[model samples]
Target: MHQIKRRSFLAATGAVLISPRLTAQPAEASQPGSLGASVTIEREPLHALPRTQYGHFLEHLGRCIKGGVWAEGESEDMFLGGIRRELLAEMRAVKPALIRYPGGCFADGYHWRDGIGPRSQRPLRKNLAWSRLGQKLGPEEDNHFGTDEFLRLCEELGAEPQLTANVGSGTAAEAAAWVEYTNGPKDSKWGSERVKNGHPEPYQVKYWFIGNEILGWHELGWQKPVQYVETLKRYAQAMRRVDPGIKLLASGTFGPNPNHAEIHQTLLQGAGDHFDYLSVHLYATEWVAPRNLWRYQILNRQRRPSRGLYYEIMAALSVQQQYLEDCISDLRQFSPAGKPIKLSFDEWNLWYRGYSDLYQSNFNLRDGLWVASALNLHHRYAQELELANISQMVNCLGLIVSTNQGTFPTASALVFRIYTENVGDELLPSQVDGPALPHPTGLPVLDVSATRQGDTLALFLVNRHLDAEVSSRCTCQGLQVGTVAKRVELHHPDAFKYNTYADPRALRISERSETLKVESDGAASRFSVQLPAHSLTCLVLEAKNL
Candidate 1:
């Protein structure tokens, strides 16, 4: 039988104590995949921007809150060392610019003070929205993991905090006080309390969400458009007076649907001017029949259509973009000079298909592919979107799964790691001019992101082809290439193979120089590369003057 243990093994000691078994995994399976020929990456002049809109969310539901990040009992590790280690690892992987917490639907009823101070002394409150017990889990949970803990974690993870304020079942004062507690330093009682709790420095987190999913059909029944707009306006104005430098995100409906559009329009008309960003939520799933598998074989038999995972991928993204465009258009109709507000997809992931329901399901191949596709979609649209959190990053709908006792990286986590590592500060321009791969259902041949590091051109390619490898050329004008440096890939024959503590390398990056080739200087000198079926490739080229 396999065994697991935890000791004071220090990778970055004093900072945190992660378990040893957590990082150990079996050897990667042998690689014998075919590497055919040389390919050229055409020289292109690039004007790219930082992908700041890349953000993440952490919720207090499922394994996310209890066993995922915080351990209640007194252990040598104050903040649950194991969970801290897992969080650090995930943060390193996703490289998220911002981290939103204590929510999804949980934020509406969240009390900031309930999860602080002494763990046992904190009272357990009713979590009406996302409790697994259908009632309070215990006497009332101590506020062991509260604002201080979240900000501390954010600081440790090198991410900006995106605090969600309470709107329903909470007054404007409680919300404003929270902003003060985090941003305010030791000039007042709350600030003193923050210092007394071990961190003397003010967090000064800049992004705040007024509330979450207020437009959902069965939300706490807080308000209709006019009321929501009024409440949000009051909350934003009051909170801004407390800390004017902070950016407030006014919640918007995810719509085109009647319910979403009505509330969306109302919120825009009511409080659009007082905010820095517009928040929206979207998750794609196939909750039925041939779409969702029989649970048992889900890790194996599941396969996305040759074209794409779901028809709704394009539809959902299109709808969200359209919604934001229309909302902004409506806003500009009145205040043409109003500050532009981009989309913050703070909550999104591959849900439905019972995949979301299987909280502890190991990261297998199918999940990894979906995660890769979703992130690719985000990179493609990064110009308009400001923040995209891969909803619930640990335990529940997580990129990594952990119990207070231990943790395991999932396929989804690997996808985030691969994507974040390859794409850099400059999002370069690229054209996937190959013949579009067609299926009974529509599917594009390639999913691509081009970026430049100095004069070196880097391309992140996701080939969604099921059978045939896609052969294509990238032509960039007014630049010269010296040599093709390296071509690396993350691929496996079984798209669902997962990394377990026992075998972590099941789906990892492999390097092969033979898979790429370059021919220099001419219209016919365009760089050509064959994107393997269902694989992700990163190609880099060094520049040379012609």
Candidate 2:
């Protein structure tokens, strides 16, 4: 039997050994010893560079609508500092290229006209869907934040506005008029009215969605596939006639399956060419765990529920992907549009629990690292998937969490902010290798992706191991790598260590660097990296181009 030495074992696996005697260097040291031998890496070029805007979304659910962008005093006259400046600043910091608004299910029952006009005149309608505490039940639904408010917020945030037209419980005319109000120039009545409201500028938001999740009616009423598609088609036609520059997206099903695929294919066939993007939702959690306690529950929620649980989830993801494939596949067969229809995975997060009356949770360090891992998945698959949002932006499973007094960045948000900034736009070629190391629970080793910005190459690594550490060599192919420019890691002894506004550092990308080791030859260069078990790290490599 081959016996591994203690140092070799520790360095190879990149672990934080629980045994008291197993100390190497401090956790912050670069040369924490070495494994038995060096590993060789082959070269490969990354492809299908996606635009940065491929990561964004909006849903007027949870605190996202009430306390988030729709702050209290947005209007000139009806002002009271309702919007959270700090929260807005945090979101702006993310540099979202586009933001869809006004609903998740909230879009289904929304009346755009109600959210317009004078606050005093705006009628009070019972928010049947999201009001868990019955907060909007009394006099709170006076409609403080309306169309004008959202447009202004968009401008302030420097993001493209993606408004969802009311399809369920609304007519095509209502959707058209709303577009006219936002995009129409000053001469028209609606345009003039917008000018009179305080701002004379036409809010030219070219991207719009016909409806949001109309097929599912949990809180809001549901529309059958045919009805939803037809309504969306009508809305698309009228919206385009008013502003031909508009980019529209049809609502795809919740996940993968023949039913969902048929729904997407049918919808696309009816209104495929008219739209520019398709919307879908995905969440990683134990929601799909099997009933057998052992079968369903995995030690790590970040990974799929062991192998047994993923059987359903992967099938679901496959269903969603096939639907997307079919939409474009079918559309291309008929319409000769230059660009393929893109995907907007607008609503997604690791939602296992915590969706209750409040719908908010302070994600721990493990959750944060997982958030980064999921985002890395987005970067790797950027060719097909574009515009992915981590569900709620602020409170309520948001990247950033809030309190009645103040707000702070969540672990997930921090990781996302770091990953996005470095990897945006600079497309390069990269790849991952290592056998599929399955956990005792049966999930495979973590996933990773790479990209480049200028001469800087970014390597995003994720370790999905729960109880054990993974020993794998990550080798970048083809490029001549220099010293490691920066290294940021998010990890903790416990997966549940989270950040609070007062002590946000409780669990974070606690340490980072602009230094590392790079070795190469005339043919190719490689940077050595060790991903901590159950953690995520980004290795920045500056290439020496010949």
Weakest 10 consecutive residues of candidate 2 by summed lDDT: 13-22
Residue-level lDDT of model 2, residues 1-546, one tens digit each, is 133332232122111111112112212212222222123433444455555433454455556556654556543332234666666777777777666677666676678878777788889876644553345311245567777777777787777777887776677888888888898889886788888887788898787777777776442446787777677778888887788888887777554445655677777666666787777765544343222233223323433223332222222222333344654454445332565777777776655433331255567666665666566556655665766665667665577765455677777777776676667354455444443432232234555666666667776666654444545555555567777467777777655566776776687565466555555666766555666665777677676454
Q: In candidate 1, what are the lDDT values of residues 1-546, reduced to their tens digit?
A: 111111111110011111111111222333333323322333453434445555677777656766567764525554444345545675666776778988766788788878666556777676654443333221134456777778877877788888888876677888888877787868776777777777777889798888776655444444666777778788887888778899888777543444554555566656778777777765554323232234214322323321233222322333344444555454445321556566676766655323233244455555666566666566555655657776767767677766654566777776676666666656655555553433332345576776667767667777755445666665555456544457778777765466766665667777766433555455433567777766777777664435
Give the CA lDDT, 0 to 100, for residue 68 in model 2: 55
| Model 1 ranges off by over 4 Å | 1-48, 72-87, 132-140, 255-262, 288-336, 354-358, 361-363, 404-406, 437-441, 512-516, 522-525, 543-546
**lDDT, candidates in the order shown:** 0.60, 0.60
Q: What TM-score does candidate 2 reach?
A: 0.79
Which numbered prediction scores highest in TM-score against the true structure?
1
